[model samples]
Target: MNKFLFGLLLTSCSALGGNSQYVNPFIGTSNFGATHPGAQYPNALASVSPFNVAHGGEQNKFEKDAAWNSRVYIHENRYLTGFSHLNLSGVGCPDAGVLLLMPTTGPLELDAREYGSSYSNEQASPGYYSAQLNKYAVKAEVTSSLRTGLSRFTFPAGQSNVLLNLGLGLTNETGASLKWVSEQEVEGSRMLGTFCYHDEDVRPVFFVARFSKAPKTFGVWKKMPRYQNVEADWIGYNDSIKPYPGYRQLLSGDDIGAWLSFDTREQEAIEVKLGISFVSMENARENLDTEQPGFEFDKLRIEAQKAWDALLDRVEVEGSDEQKTLFYTALYHSLIHPNILQDANGDYPLMGQQGVGNSKQNRYTVYSLWDTHRNVHPLLSLLYPELQADMVRSAVAMAKESGWLPKWELYGMETQVMVGDPATAMIADSYLRGIRDFDVNAAYGAMVRAAEQREHNLLRPENPDYLTLGYVPVDDEGPYDGSVATSLEYYLADFNLAQLALALGKQEDHDKYLARALNYRTLFDADTGMLRPKNRKGEWLTPFDPELGRNFEPAPGYIEGNAWNYRFYVPHDTPGLIQLLGGPEAFLRQLDATFDTGNFDMGNEPDITYPFLYNYLEGQSWRTSRRVRELIAAHFGNHPGGLPGNDDTGTMSTWLAFSMLGIYPVSPGMMDYALFRPSFSKVKIHLSAEYYPGKQFVIENPVGDLDSDKPEAFTLNGRSIDKPFVTHEDIIKGGVLKVK
Candidate 1:
């Protein structure tokens, strides 16, 4: 740790007093081309876990995406639309926050990509986003929750009217319709929100948005590719978000015109608060009234900070300036979602096959189970076990109502996106880590159903190729026609369940799942000695380019990525994989080769766990050190798009987290950690007496004996545990670690 950075670290921690403010949630705030608004109030999101400041750019809510990207509004996305809300902290895919409202006057039209304007960093903030609508000369600021946000526009003198267009296309490839309830309020949210990229569930999406400023002239418009058809839903009532979604001649991708013009003063600031509700507009209003009453910006800001403090306090860091900055930033990313979906009184509309209604519990949002199951959730369970249990119970309850466990469930819909039975992995890992607070029977049922069903079953398909050939081959006769990714994910998940079941005393189920855990071996191409792909009859794909994408080679590799990424993805079997790679020497060689060749695609998630594999190779300890140091320094920069890939709601940053702490969780259901080189000479994990009374994870550098000019070294609990590897139980129980 450099002295300058380290000194800055001291003052920053000192300011936090009992909690930390060292984390600049705004760091990655601009990354992915936009900054995440760690300030807005989400009733469902526990608090603002501001981990990174990587830039995406400034927006309305610090997090909410705006009309057109202010900085770089390039078509085909590829960067950002300047929108960031109901967003995963770090993951790569884009999801919620639809109905992008832009303020324009004089013959309002649609076609957002064209109508939207651009701005610079000086325009955005937490809970507020401002940009000069290039064409209209209007300055706009936007803010919101997963369901609703408010836009306050200061119009130029000529146009006092504010515009609200439902046809302004957003993500998810769906259009929205507006029913003019009053001059100021439009009763609707984004219609048919985006899918979970993987196309998981096929449920209609709906949200009711109540705007603050009524328009002098307000009406609905249908978006046409080139223009718009402004219409009026005059006498009709917008009952709620439930029944009205599919019953209309709503706008299309072509109909891009809708606007609400409201008269305003020249020097006037019209603040529009749009309350969103999954169940009803009444509920959205109720949520707004409870959390954010009367636009008191200061009050909201304080409340937002308080929420962030509560979560950041879960762990504490003491290190160099840069190290602490990275630490707090990583910590901030950790709590971005699984947002609080219910109202203040504890009620939320469930997104299920049964459709719109209040949930059994406070339904959570921002599920990155596929990305987070590995470490993010595990980290959460380790600190906030009670919350982990609640989340587990929430998953189970959703499964009970929806028939099958949803992949990426949002309000009343299962956007079956992403691969893997991650719900199973999360539950299983939580249970194994001592976070068993759900219906054991129901959880096991979901777990078994996911693993046992035929591959074609919508809820739980029996994987024929997975069952027969041990991998998903292109030539396999189908029921389930997907990628090898699902099988690989299921293999990991099933293994976790098997271990969890064994611990929970479900013997038969344990044995069944245990057998399923070995399914990864089917894809293990012994010829290449790496987990590769094959044809149905067990023949390797011809001219298989492990680096090629799925569409080209299909089942020869997993979905979304190549075999190189997935090859070392066996978290449950590092030792087996190490052995398969020929031993510690060969394992180290191959891992080195993966990185040395620079083919590890830091731009993806599969190989995230790969860097830490050196910990298992006994004598080859330094490799882990080198890789950890290099990865943290290279990909995790302090800029937007600074990420090697989608933060995966924080999985990547969480990887930074463990790396910064000098440890990483290699197994989903295991409590042990594969060690690495600590970025600082010392790091302390704050422990709670409630969960872990009289406990803490203390890392004291072994090089403490050296002078200030000398380099730093590590030691654990006083004695240096030469080589790598540690356990969750070790640190949480609090023993002094001397790494000097």
Candidate 2:
């Protein structure tokens, strides 16, 4: 089909159907967004993403090894390696971008550099992606179920081959084992981890790839290690791809792959489906059989699209085509992580342990707590409370099995990627927002243990000093050594924990954590109006520059950002922070300075709530609305580079989604949302019947007030709401919020 006809067909299909049609999956695929236009189901364990980072072509600006490339596919990169299954999306670190499946014609090429081709005619939606390989005139399309990935490749009449390259991946770790289970099946386990370059936190991911038709011939190959000694002369296959034609047994090596060759008629289409699990190979195959029993590509594609539509339908909006596309795409990215981890039979790898565990409900992975704790979990609590409840259960289960809450968990393993005890805040926030189906007592106990366990505390190494000095001392050496930043994170976590304690009627614990939560005040410098680094002697560090850590450069007491970015980061106690900053007027001035001086980083999490801070000052809420609208206009759009930076596993996207919806959960543990003017004429949010009292909540802008950033006033359910904010309770008793 021509581009114009294809566009018309897509428009017709979208008009006839669901919200998934509004999603542009490729929006965050560029400008370091770390999101790929992959075929992913909402919160699915498996995804099929085009792998293009391994080989560098003239069209490619970034390669896997050239820089800190954390994604499997880049929007600008035209070179295509294969479709990698079991991929991680919107992450800043590399892991799980493995199990490459590619098709080539004429001759079998095991090397990715040789088999890789430039691709064109790329297209993607919520649950599907397709592209035409320019080199071989072949078309590749992909879709997925909950735990399985499916791909269809159309080849020209010739000798065609499908290769499953186990060696090439974005993971830092190495070594894999591949075996031919049958003529039409291949099973393998690839070592994946060292996330963010940590060596000891590695684990194997098992997968089973099944083909639609048996190959004419198949073989497993290994790239033998090159020898430097005299034996090099005799080793012909050393450093070269060694093929074992028809060898069906198992082979283990750092660089190995399997290829299946066959002669095809004109435009012959072959399907490959993959099932993956963290527990075992049998479970992987079982997941495949249970989720995908047949090779009906279009049927599965429609089913996957419907699955996405169900999730996307939660928020319906009326807007322009571009506006709707950006809104739905952001919503799409936000729902992609903390995915289902358990296999078909409810079995998953025990958290940081050496055994299999079973969950009656869904077990979730990819915590990315430091990022998702801010907005993603809270968003889920409102829109999909049952899923949020399972996620809370997953966190508590992790504490039971691993003895500590996950910091940046992946595949049930603690990478300890980011700082602070974010899981405490996540669970407490979920529970405070009325998601209380999990064991709150056990969760609180875990929080207290991580808070008080000074020795060998995995979550908080700065705990001992924090307990004594009321803040993390700048003297400590390690990842958690960001005294001001780490201390700020702990304060937020402690504040959330205190709220949970108060809700559970533990006054003593509440008082204790509440006091500890105020420790952020100890790091505040009245002179600079920013949190400054302090040592054990209660002395501020010399030569303080609030902008020292800008652009992710290291400062004395900050991580990922400067002190100015974190100045207004005290979300739990904005009043206290405002008082410390000299008052509401001074706070507003400093906050304005942060934005006016180019110090506000919309990409990072520390400063995400700054725009919403204007809601705290009386009648200054218009500033919040204006800043949010301007930020969205400047940083987001309906293109590959729409996102400002890394989605941080949907943190940035969730921020955008919430901003577009005219509400901001300024603090996680808080039940209230700071309101603003939405970007749409009408937005209807379908509430979960199991968790919410009302059926739906709608925000209406009847006068087309979207052109203006700020609203004069607001009325909920036909009654005036004095302040530009609403509680979780108010929203769940759902009705329309009309902008006047």
Candidate 3:
């Protein structure tokens, strides 16, 4: 691309307001154990991928399989599995990509993991997703939104045909059932639910898929072949594979070979309108009318682009073209989840309940706390308070409708994914900091239940061990043997819950949960002074090496990291955690030791929260300045791998955004921000009126000690302040923090 053309494109995108011309939605759309080839549009209510027998799974997943290169049936999971009407972005799990629809001929295998062809990066994009199916010599192009999708497939003129293979599953093969409801409308679908992380996090969702296509000859078939569309439109074999009024097609294969047909005139165009609802097919149709009434391809695309533009303009960055793409793309991904849960008339299906109704507060899904807690949700509390309040409320509602608060929520189902009762911290931190729109009592109830729930992702209980020992024991029988990482997370959650209980005025609950918070002491190895794992026999386990980062899967003992990563995890009671680390000087020394010893793996979440822990430590104020800058430099850039760890959806980027704006959530449940040097010279934060109008955390880089070249100095409005952190309330309620 030439400079003039680039400038023209920039100007055009600017006219569109926020959608970036530089944004290559295809960036993370490929690698990183993800089948992110871009199909299910952001915030869409359906599994809306275009027709094709490819697309493996989430972003960057196929690098492992030997047949990966040849596999065209991309069994997408953790994302809108080829636009099947539902998905969770950025999670490392598999679910909801069932019912493969291929406009093909010949034999089709109900399971797509076979024969699914590999795709190239050059084909996928934000408003468009494309790939070639080697089997049929056909090219599939898909564009989508929460409600509608436009699929255009080009095949050989003479043998033109398309088939809607209704037997495929997103990630799970069995739970998905589809049947035809009416000649035009079909519904009924189930994904038995998904196991998020191990077994602790599970998402049980039932959807009614409504297709705009006319019901033609329909039966349940799995491994059938290809065909094309004869009609200008096609009913997308809505997931009613159960019975009459249901699109249920239980196949033993050979019965449904992608449900065939073809057009003698327009082999060039075949449009598919897919509407999905956890509520019902009626609601799904209602959603389609609400979002895309006519389903005109170009108009919907323009509208989607316009919607994206409005969001992108929230924060404008001045940078190179590539940098702008990476930055804005990150921003785009950040706003995606906690999606618009309420239907057209503002109704939503409550979590843990089968019914649907109006949301008391706005409901959103996709909770990536284990990764996002560090910065993402906090960012929402700061920028989009209303939405944040809605999210907090939704989490609260889940507590009411469901038995416990959600860990990894998709729709209203809690896929007990990841570790920790993170929503505890998220809601507490939000409300305490003044995002009070969510139900306080309900929030408390959810927090309490989360703390009490014994079953975790590992499918083990917090039962005897968590209550008696204060952590997931290394001696547990499951895949997640009790180790340091799980224990540390449990302690932090307990501490956060304690704070929430106190704020809500539940004195007894406060004391109880707070005591649990201090349980980290049980895991603290006083002799070595590092928070380590304790064996079942009441003895501290030796071989305390931080660098190895064991205990997580693929590794095992730790969670998804090692000892060095897990050691600094006591954010809620950092002062207490500090004492366990020996003392302030020892703690800071250990923190510094982390930096110098090359164990500071900024790429992971277990470590990002560490830089902010200094605020709780008395003398370590200065190190935060140096470390935050270094991590930002190392992790964020104009490239794809710029994310350190999983990026855990927007969690990783939230760290960058917050750090750049000059603060860190030392204690999330509390609004206090540990001060850090600003990345940009000046950042005028967009704060909420509730958080004190006209008061934004502003930074002016007079000295610009970005490289840590100058000796650090701290001050408040020209006077040197003794402390390193400022309460978010202090910033909001109007106070001057001048640091130099």
Q: Residue 545 deviation, candidate 1, in Å?
A: 3.7
CA lDDT, candidate 2, residue 183: 95
**Which is better, 1 or 3, measured by TM-score?**
1
For all candidates in order, the CA lDDT equals 0.58, 0.87, 0.57
Native-vs-model 2 lDDT? Answer: 0.87
The digit string of per-residue lDDT tens for model 1 on 1-740 reads 23244234333423334344455444443445233533344234322221111123332334244333322122112212223223344434444434344566555444344344444322222233344555666665554443445556667665554444443232444554455455544555455444534454333233334455555655555532223334843443321111122223343332333355556667566765555555555676676666556755434444444655676666665565567667766766666556666665566665465444455555676576777788888888776676676677778877787667766666556766566788888887887766655787898887777776775544435365566656666664232333566667878877888888888787997888778777777667767766665666677667777666523244345666677777788888888877777888887777888788665866566777887787777655566667777877787754444456556667777888888776778888777887655676666676756566546676655444312322224456566676566777776677766543
Per-candidate clashes, comma-separated: 97, 0, 104
Q: Candidates ranked by lDDT, best first?
A: 2, 1, 3
Regions of model 1 farther than 4 Å from truth = 1-95, 103-115, 121-158, 173-175, 194-267, 356-360, 459-462, 469-471, 477-484, 550-555, 688-690, 702-716, 719-723
Q: Output the lDDT of residue 357, model 3.
A: 65
Deviation (Å) of 711 in candidate 1: 13
Comparing 1 with 2 on TM-score, the higher-scoring candidate is 2
TM-score quality measure for candidate 3:
0.79
- For residues 470-577, write the lDDT of model 2, one tens digit per residue: 888888555435888889999999999899999999999899999999888888888888888888899998888888778677778888889888888899999889
Candidate closest to the true structure, highest lDDT = 2
